[model samples]
Target: MSDLHDLFLTCPKGLDGLLLEEAQALGLTEARAQVSAIRGKGDLETAYRLCLWSRLANRVLLVLSRFPVSNAEDLYLGVNAVSWSDHLEADGSLAVEFSGKGSGIDNTHFGALKVKDAIVDNLRAEFGKRPTVDKVNPDIRVHLHLDRGQAVLSLDLSGHSLHQRGYRLQQGAAPLKENLAAAVLIRAGWPKIAAEGGALSDPMCGVGTFLIEAGLIAADVAPNLKRERWGFSNWLGHVPAIWKKLIEEAQQRAEVGLAKTPLWIRGYEADPRLIQPARNNIERSGLAEWVKIYQGELATFEPRPDKGQKGLIICNPPYGERLGDEASLLYLYQHLGERLRQSCLGWSAGVFTGAPELGKRMGIRSHKQYAFFNGALPCKLIMLDVEPRQFVTGERGERSDAAPAQGAAVIEQARLSEGGQMFANRLQKNVKALGKWARKEKIECYRVYDADMPEYALAVDLYRDWAHVQEYAAPKSIDPEKAQIRLLDALAALPQALGIPTERIVIKRRERQTGKKQYERQSAEGRFMEVEEGGVKLLVNLTDYLDTGLFLDHRPIRMRIQREAAGKRFLNLFCYTATATVHAAKGDARSTTSVDLSKTYLDWARRNLSLNGLSDKQRLVQSDVMEWLREDRGEYDLVFIDPPTFSNSKRMEGVFDVQRDHVELIDLAMARLAKGGVLYFSNNFRKFELDEGLAARYQVEEISAQTLDQDFARNSKIHRAWRISVR
Candidate 1:
């Protein structure tokens, strides 16, 4: 083996340029960038320097032999040609990582096995002993790449991928690989920003990846200074004196950089559990003095005034992986954009996300967007310069201004047009009329506005002092801009008429939903408020979900449940948040069983039940309602079945269409009914037609009219109810 050898420094795709630049800076000769790896010529010392200092590399590989091979026999001969004694002893352990396909070596595992056989056979012939294979923590790590009948064999100089900086002992879900994090920081211009004494902030930092990477960059600290092991630690070709000198020099540079670098770095995570891990990672990285992390929500995240006005705000907010994540993430992205526009003026902001459509919801134009991959998932890094022009104006022409006076501008701009005035007048009238009835009924939550005007197209509900607005999705025939203006007009008029702050008003677009769409989370804010209805305290989350915990139109139905629930065993089917179950429990029912397919809502029901001290004799079961009804043998005196109009949740064995499945669902519930039981079935399918056979089989009465309280009088078709009893 030659002392000077061809080398390759591999990195994640899209980071080849950065790795090449770092290799050149490290004085490697003839450096050239490949697809995801950089090729260079260097000696053992140069390789050691790259291993210790290169932040963008995943591994540093020293090429041993390159040859053309057509079959397994040829592959074995090519592998045996290398001098194994130069890198590994016969008694040492070794491992092989093979990749690519060609030349009759179609399977990676088979190719790796063949190469391992060649190495062992060569060593046995030369020294009558062969190295044993150790998959983990091996003394020698070898890599084989095959393409188009050519194989390139190399020795892995980094035991693990260089991305494992060894500082993070713990991390949250989907933590960014350290090399990828370094790439994001470099692309965000963190090094130049730090050179200019600028600061860095990550408002939604989960494990402080960005902050730690930024700290390392700002302080000129070697990326692997704390790493204790390497692939070549026991190699015969390794030079201990040269490696020691490099380590000492890196330590001296880090010491001076730590003292002289003036960089302000901070991270904020909403989850308290993530805070301690983030702190631990930062401390382990030896950047504790330069970085700070705090537990906080994004709504209150602001740039530190003392840290100056310019810096970088970079974050990799959760790229929702589950079914319900997109809806919830939309609001989070919107809030992030708003915060950037309001508090990060004169700074640069970069948002890395796998869901680019969610990024569009930010309402800010991006200056640049670079495509990269988070593992196999293609993602984008959106870079925005937070200038005045980047601030998006709302429908009322309210721009995000950093000054306090900007809020007054928003309120002042909230004026009503002639149509808007008429809409506002109608809302005021309904509030006055409903206000009286709500006070008399002791109801703190009720529908105050229900698309009173066609142009307005909104349902406004009052939850105590808070206003929850659900905008009806406008028709495709209407110009989107016009509909947006009308929405803006309605949003502005609500706060003025209701005497509430804009922050207290939560808005969601309500369209006809199918499947599990409606149950999807809209945000992870978890901001719940306690509201009283029928003298029961219920937890309501207006911003986190499409439907508030309690349905305003179902007030009379719950009241009826309370009236007839005394001394009876109550079963609430499709018990969303179990608000009716709470009413039944309050009504002194003998026992209550709430069944729903959603564990999230069941947990919410548990909390609501706990809030009212109604935990005894109450069971919250997570099961498919239809399946549960078929399997349940226990009898109940009063049963309430309020199911969705259509559901195709994977949790359910089959599809559920209320109009089609109503009779079957009723029969199943009726089978579990007691001798004098009454089954109340309800749904919101507007064109529902009751099965005439059900009426003949049992006593059936349409109580939908009675179920509509005064608050829901304007829309009696909101839900239909039927009372069934055995004849």
Candidate 2:
């Protein structure tokens, strides 16, 4: 064998470019990037150095042979050609890992079995003893890749994955892998920050992954310095003297780096149980002098470094994946943003999160964003320059005065007239009461003031920061002059009471529309904003339509569908924007089909699906729901049909009046449901009632009380829903 060898270093997805850069820096020649891996030419010593210093690599493999393979026989012959004795002893243990699929073998388990059989057969013929199979702590780990009629074999030189640095034997519920944490730190510019003698802090640090990794980088200590076992330890081709020299050199560099002025690094964790574990990890990494851990709440978290210090504030906040998590996470991000603006002025910050939408609520603009993947979940690292320019001051929530460190903003409350004061007080009371329930249930869009007093007959809906106010058309008996005067008073008190900007309040007239007039385009401004519910993203435009595209009263219905849609087929009829189907698809539904008569809403539904990356296996049909139901033959496990109160569109064959046509629509939808399947029917008409005869035809239960969330509790007549099932 030649001194120069072919090597491949595997890494997590999105780190391929970083792995190539690190490999070349570690003396791997002619390095090239591949999918989640790097291939290069390196000598044995170079390979050893890379295994020791590579912070982003998962494993390093040394290629032994590449041969053409047509079928299983060719794979066996190709494996038998390599000299097994040169790598693994006959009495030693081995493991086989096979990837890719081609030729005859279509499954990875069968391919691995065939390769193992060939290796054992070859060893038994030569030494009269076959090696034992050891999946854990194997002496030799052989890997095979069969692709495009060819096979390449390699020996794993780093033993287990390099991400297991052995320092963190215990972690929190969700721990970032060591290699990925290091990659996040590097991308966040920790190396450059450390070189400038700056400090580092993680406010929500779990078990010190970021702190220990940052210390290792700053101290010039190899990430695998504490690892005692390696794949090459028992190999016959290993050189003891060359490995010893590399270890000595690494130790010297580490000692010199540690003896210098230590960098100020600290971690604050909310969980008291995690503080000790984080401290233990810091001590085990020999970074006790440079790092500290404190049990602190995020509300009171204030990192204190030496005076005249401006450094990086990096944190990996929890990106929860639950139905009721967005509302709480919105506040959490806002609190972090408030802290950054209040306490960490002139410092840089990086917030790594899988929930990028919540990150936008932080009220700061991240100048740079880098995409990465944590196993399969894609995430983004939002890098912020914590200067005056990065603080978010948009038209929705403009900061009128200098931001006060204590709370959200420092807006001077406007002086209210006698009537406006009462209106503001009433609005403030409703916000205080509803905000708590909103956070508890994760309700983003809600009705705040629904004409509590007859004098001010307007309904207000809060969608995140923007407020949608619809003035109810008054009876001619009430003076029109007084109604206008009250509206103007409410407008004057809105910005102060709600703590939002005047430009974000959308006012519209809510009159009784004559036929299909409600469906007409209200405006063309097209200012769409994204909102989250049940862990799915939805697009809503307040100024473009009469409705915001998401009905707050139907949130519970959508969440139930999201929870029950795994591996099931889902259908939506009269699907305005297909928001419920979006939730179902995100819940891992096998397939989704949405039917509607409006081509405009179908196009909007397409955008909603694509936004959440749920476009695969989702079908959108632009046809009237009744007509489509008659022609469609596909069966569905879950169906949702929420029709308008009345419609007389030119596109439809006939009029759709819920009071007159609901029974026929329900029967048509029930025909498409599979046995033991569910179909949810709802309508906004206050007096709408289900046909009494249909209950005898199918199992039906009224779920209106259960479907009404806290936001719509006051207005029980907003909508009514039913759960119909096949008997």
Candidate 3:
């Protein structure tokens, strides 16, 4: 009954060895690292000590049984044979959690269900009573893992994953995973540095993961110092006195170091959105009194004279992946390096990046490069030793030429810790599954969208025969460029999935605001054109929006209008490129009128019309569609009304949001329509709710069916297209 037991501690990736060291240092002997995990042999009290004190481990599990499991039946028997009552009470509630790789059983839920069944059935058959399953918080949490036909059942000693440090009351977009953040700090040698009075800094810290981790380590604060509950609380052989003594010891350790000058932990970002969460994280860590954060562009940032003098400057800059446009983030990276090099003399710098191209812009050679996993991105935490001269000259504005960029190299055999790879592989599998579905459904002309925010992490949409299926990788931080490259790689399969040739597919990247897009004065006319290629003409417009011309998601809608335009009088309202009008004119429309508020857009629309062989008779009007609809009396057989969600300083006489006044806009377009004319009304606002009353007033049918192009199959709301007529 008192035999030493083999147990495992699961930490976030890169912290397995560190956790092993921590456990061994705490007298849990025979510690070993196994893929984001640490294993050791001890009685149940060792598990209690880990739950109470271990910082890097996500969870500690008591190994119940290990057996060869070929299938679900094998899994059941292996789990059922374990003495469930030995740990969990007959009337107690238990939960089974499962995770595995290279096993016949792939579905984690089904695997968990099998394990649950085995436990319940065994207890019922043996003692005539079955334990209840509690998911929210189980009295006893069991873990069933299968790896290469081997099943290992264990009891979860940590009620929850260790990453829930209980300090973070708020978070920003793609906040670093707590365990990964800890691993990053440990890897950066924060514990050792802090012990030696070497300061820590996170210049681009969104939520102060680096700085907070550093502060906790420096203050001798246990990673779980603030956590309320651990699974060992319910274990049969728990040691309350020893746990209390250890906690008190940790508190006593924390009380010793009250540094007069605050620990040099500081974070800065241009956006207040990031700053808000950084403050919350720091405050929650109880380091608010010690840590300082500032809001300003990196270019304008002046490092405090006394701080970061001989400290570390760490930054996780925006990767063009989720935020969009790698080409634009270069200046930000360069600016950051310039600021650090100019101001932070004698500072050691750590730049963690998924985008190696941005690394070139830093203009400094790294002394060491630590390959680490920031989620799935095979990122490099490049360390640079800065000399005072480098700082002085960099401050003096020795700006270097922005180097020409190259594609990010594909990461091969990225070594991820156990759960890291598992989750990443599972995510990769799901993305691949979505990609496969896209191909099978003949999807094309669709957006792979993640509109939620921070513009990063993961989401993909496949456009197929008039339908869209969106696959998302809920919000999690990864390398921005890696995320984008993966998205593009998935996108490369889109045309094939939709049965459309790659030549016909158009890729439009949303641009981020930087010096490239910033113009002191708006050009009077937008200069863009229609280029003919591979049997179809492509219209590209640059001036009116962050994007150039093509709205690839509307490919099917535009084609449908073209197909229906022969012998019809066409009207394109809020037309930017007027590509649809040109397509209509190409289909022999009797006449066409293209209206938009932007004179720049109107000129681009005119060029599209001219490029498509349309004459002056197919008029391009530079006027607001809303105002034009009020005065225009001309009737048309085909009308296209696509308005922006909101615009203030536009050519439009007034602002417009399609969701707010779409009914009136539709009514106005219908007033200028012929008796049997068809009105194609559309908007890109995904949350737009169609007004049934407005549709009832007119003879309308949701022509979303016709507008569903092969490429736009993933989401029909890339734009909601409808057909209406006056009753």
What's the TM-score of every candidate structure? 0.74, 0.62, 0.58
Candidate 1 — worst ten consecutive residues by lDDT sum?
Answer: 406-415
lDDT, ranked from best to worst = 1, 2, 3
Candidate 2 overall lDDT versus native: 0.86
Candidate 2 structure quality by residue, lDDT tens digits, 531-634: 88877889998887777788877889999999999999999999989999999999999999999888888999999999999999999998888888889999
What candidate 1 gets wrong by more than 4 Å, as runs, is 1-3, 294-309, 322-344, 355-365, 394-443, 447-462, 465-530, 534-553, 558-680, 683-690, 698-719, 723-727
- As a whole number from 0 to 100, the lDDT of residue 91 in candidate 3 is 74
Worst 10 residues of 2 by lDDT: 407-416
Number of residue pairs clashing in candidate 2, backbone atoms closer than 3 angstroms, sequence gap of 3 or more or interchain: 0
Query: Which candidate number maximizes TM-score?
Result: 1
Candidate 1, position 538, lDDT: 95
Give lDDT tens digits, candidate 1, residues 600-660.
9999999999999999999999999999989999999999999998888778888999889
Candidate 2: misplaced stretches above 4 Å? 396-727
Task: Rank by TM-score, highest first.
Answer: 1, 2, 3
Off by over 4 Å in 3: 1-3, 101-106, 125-127, 258-261, 305-309, 322-324, 388-727
lDDT of 3 by residue, 1-727 (tens): 3478888888766667777788898768788889988888987656666776676778888887889987788888888888777777777788888999545688898899999999898888878888898887778888978888988888888888887888787777767777777666666667777777777666677777777877877777777877777776776656677678778877776666534446777777767877877788778777776787888766666556353346677777766552234324644665566666566656677787776555644556566777666676777777776553222123222433332235211111112223333334444554455566456644333344443222233333333322122323333466656565444433333333345443333333443223224212222235444444212465653333444455665666677877898998899887877778777887778888888767756766776766656766788887767788899988889998877776555344455666778878887887888888888888777688888888668877777756664434544565677778777
